[model samples]
Target: MSKSITITNEDILQEIKLSCKTPEIVEQIVSRKVIISAAKEAGIEVETEELQKAADLFRLINKLTSAEETWAWLEKHSLSLDDFEAIVYSSVIFGKLSQHLFTDKIEPYFFENQLDYAGVVMYEVVLNDEDLAIELFYAVKEGEMSFSDVAHKYIQDTELRRKGGYLGIVRRQDLKPEISAAVFAVTPPQLLKPIVTSKGLHLIFVEEIIQPELDNKLRNQILTNLFDEWIKQQIQPVEFVKLFELGS
Candidate 1:
C-alpha cells in the first residue's frame, strides 16, 4: 500500500513559522487586502466576459492548457475552482488599476528616462591574467585576431566558447561602473582595453548599442512599475495584525 500523510492547518502554520516565512506571508496578505480595498474605493467594475478572458490568460500563462491540467494544478496547489477564480479576479483588478492610473504617464516617463533603457550587445572573455587580457585585447583591436578567435582559443567554458562569449543585450545599469563607462564610451565593432575586476580581467567587444523604444510592450512595463511603486506607498500607513499566529 502507498504510504500517506495528512497535514492539518496547525501543521501548516507551524511549518510556516519555523521556516521564518511569517513576515513574507503577512505582508502578502496585507498587500492583497490593500489592493482589494483600493479597487472597491476606485469603483473598478469587472464584467463577466472580461473576467473570463483574464482567467483564460492566467491559465495560458501558467500552462494550464486543458481542464485536466488545470484541475491537476489546482489539486497540487491545494486550491479549488473558487480559489482559482478569486486569484484571476485579483490579477484582473491589478491590470485594470495599473492602466487606469498610469496610462497617460507612460509616454512622458519613457521620454524622460530613455537613457536608462539604452542597451548594448557585447562579447566578453574573462581572463585570470591581466597581462594576457591586455595582449588579447590588443590582438583583436589590431585585427590580428577576431573576437571569436580569442573566445574559441582562450575561453575554457564549453558554452562560452561555443557562443563566442556573447553576453546578450545589457543595459548600463547591469554592468560594473568602471566597465560600463569604458564599454558605453567606445564605438561599436571596437574592442575595449581590459578592465580589472575582483573576479578577473575583462576584455569586451562592443557589438552594437540599442536605443530604447517606447512601444506597447514598454508602455505596459512602465505602467506596471509605476503601479507597483504606488501600491507600496498605499500599504505603508496601514497597520497589519498577524491573526495566523493567534490560531490555537
Candidate 2:
C-alpha cells in the first residue's frame, strides 16, 4: 500500500519562483521563440526524413531503446508524442538554419585559428616537490631511470599510477598557459623541464604533437560556435515582462 501524490502546474510555478529560476526559464522560452521566428524568416523547414533522423538521434542519446522506456520518460516529463516530435523539430531546424547562415565561415575560421586546434599526446606525473620533479626529469633524460618507473614509484593515485601517468590526446586550449607554452615549445620524444603551477610541479614527456585537421566534425563544431555567439547577440537587447509576480 503506497500513498498517491500528484504534482500540479501551480506547484511547479511556485517551485520555479522559489528556486529563483524564473528568469532562466523565461530566457529559454524567449530564445526558443527567437529561433523559431528566425527559422520562419529564413524559410528553414524540417523534412520528414530529417525529423525521423533527428528523432532517432534523440532516442539514441537518451537511451530510449524500448517503447516502454520512451513512454516512461515522456510520462516523467509530462510530454506527449507530439511534444517529443516538436522538441526534435525545433532542434533540427535550428541546426539547419545555423548551417545555412554560417557554413561559409567555417573554413576561414579554421585557418585563422589553426594553432588553437593543435593538440598533443603526452604522459604526465605531478609532484609536490620541485626538487624531486627535477631529479626525476634528469633521471628520465639521462636514461638512469624510466618515466614508467618514476610514475610507478612516486604517483599516488592508483589508476594514474597503473596507467604509467598516460594522459591521452590533450588540446592546447585544455592546458594552462604555462604548461601549454612549455609542452609545445620543444619537439617530441623529449623531456620537458619541470613546470610549476597551482597543482604542483609537472614532469612531462611529450610523445607526439598532433596537427590540426579541418574535418567535418570540426567544421560542424565551428558552425555551432558561430551560431551560439550570433544568437546571444540577438538576445541581448530584447527584454521580457513577467505576467505575474514571483511568489505571488
Best by TM-score: 2
Model 2 TM-score? 0.91
User: TM-score for each prediction?
Assistant: 0.90, 0.91
Report RMSD for candidate 1.
2.0
Error of 2 at 238 (Å): 2.2
- Report clash pairs, candidate 1: none
Query: In candidate 1, how many Å is residue 178 off?
Result: 2.2
Candidate 1 lDDT, 134-168, residue by residue in tens: 88888887889999999999899999899999989
**Window of ten residues with lowest summed lDDT in model 1:** 239-248
Number of clashes found in candidate 2: 0
